[model samples]
Target chain A: MEYKVQVIVKPLDAIANPEGKAVERALAALSFDRVTKVRAGKVINFTLEADHPEKARSITEEICQKLLVNPVMEYSEIQISQSGN
Target chain B: MDPIIKIVTFPGTNCEYDVLKQLNFLGADAELIWHQESDLGSCSGIVLPGGFAHGDYLRPGAIARFSPIMEQVIKFAESGGPVIGICNGFQVLTECGLLPGALSKNDRMRFICKTVSCVVKTSGSVLTSAAVAGQTLHLPINHGEGNYVCDEETLKYLRENNLAVLTYTEDVNGSVEQIAGISNKAGNVVGLMPHPERATDPLLGSTDGQVLLRSFIEASK
Candidate 1:
């Protein structure tokens, strides 16, 4: 089975998010004052072959643990869905 | 026999030659090792020079950690061989779990390139063994994401174990506790943001980097 996977990676809340803060300041400079707590992260999407949805999720989780995520500073959220043939 | 040092170069790594030149000048036989090579092949020390490894894709050092050569690098470090990761190489060390903490985007979100004063905090590590505590060395830092961050527990461990080897004289990039470099508990592996290779030449404005690199070369022996 083919599954589509998306991983959302971001710095932990305890870690400083300078890019997010810079974006927030830019937004405020543009007079978008209502926005607060702007945090920035990256999304990675890819497709892979797996025997089942659970297997795909596990594989995605493994990938995140091994490479996609730095547990010291970043966290990742993985989303897996069955791909349409 | 003169100690042999291996400088590992990833595809985007541009500092390999600089490091090679500096190491050779310092009297160690240093060679450039490609990222795909599986074996270190009897080298006394390994260095990961600074650059945008894997083009800094995903993140600095993120993709490079998965390269074939890194497995051997990790094993070498585990076996207590001296290893130092400079700049982006430092990022790779943290990403690979060879060192603690992560290098985050600069606090002001700017790529800073300039010389900074770093105080050696411990001479226990392979990188700082030649310097005494509280000795300040001027080294150049060039990076977009050099801010280092780690959780409190890890910070405490680093502090107690004297693993935090070098710290900035001031907050250069918002690194926690002004830390510019650190070593693993064993003190064989070290990672730092500043470019020691760049400071080896007096013409480049400072010879302070020689102190650190010399320490690493000595440790490799």
Candidate 2:
């Protein structure tokens, strides 16, 4: 089976996101007053082949822990779904 | 035998020559090591010079940390070899978990390029062994992501272990506790955002960097 995985990496809440603040200021200057908060992160999409869904999730989680996300500064949310075989 | 210091160069690394010249002037054999080659040869020390490695994609040092040569670098650090990372090299060291904490974008989000004064916080670490604690050194820092961030536990550990080596007398960036540099638990590896090699020559305006570079060279020997 093939699984579609999306890993979203974001700076930890305790850490300041300067880029996000810049974007927020730009938007506010443009009169987007409704947008009160802004944060920035990256999304990584990949396909994983595994015999079981559990296996795919486990592998993706491992990848996130080891490489996709830096534990010191960022955290990641992994979403996995069954992909067409 | 003369100690050989190897400067590891990634594709975008531009500071190897500066480090090489400084090390050579200090009477050490300095060689440039390619990022793809794993062999460390007989070098006694390693210097990861500054630059945007692999275009700083995904984050500075995130991609470069996986370079084939890094395996040997990790081994070198583990074996108690003197390894120092300057600027982007420091980012790479943190990404590889050889050093603690992470360097984030500067608080104001501007690229900072200026000579700043740093207080030597620890005299026992490999990077500061030659400098007296509380003494100031002027070094140039050029980077966007120089603000260091870490968890509370990590911060406590650093203070308890005396791993924080260099600290800005004032806040240059919003680095936690103004930490400018730190070493691993073993003290064999160190990472800092300043360009010590650039300040080694008196013509560059300050020779304060020589104090630390001299310390590193002596440790390597």
Candidate 2 lDDT, B88-121, residue by residue in tens: 9999999998998899999987999999999999
TM-score of chain A of 2: 0.92
**Each prediction's TM-score against the native?**
0.96, 0.95
Model 1: residues >4 Å from true position, as ranges? B1-3
The CA root-mean-square deviation of candidate 2, after full C-alpha superposition on the true structure, stands at: 1.5
TM-scores of chain B alone in all candidate structures, in the order given: 0.98, 0.98
Q: Write the per-residue lDDT of candidate 1 for residues B1-221, one digit (tens) a residue.
A: 44489999999999999999999999888889999999888789999999999999988999999899999999999999999999999999999889988998888778999999999999999999999999999999999899999888989999899888999999989999999999999999999999999998889999999999999999988
For each candidate, what's the DockQ?
Answer: 0.82, 0.77
Highest DockQ model number: 1
Q: Which lDDT value does model 2 have at B155? A: 96
Task: Please provide, for model 1 over A1-85, each residue's C-alpha lDDT reduced to its tens digit, 9 standing for 90 to 100.
Answer: 8998999998789888888998899999999989999999999999999999889999899998887888887899988888887
Off by over 4 Å in 2: B1-3
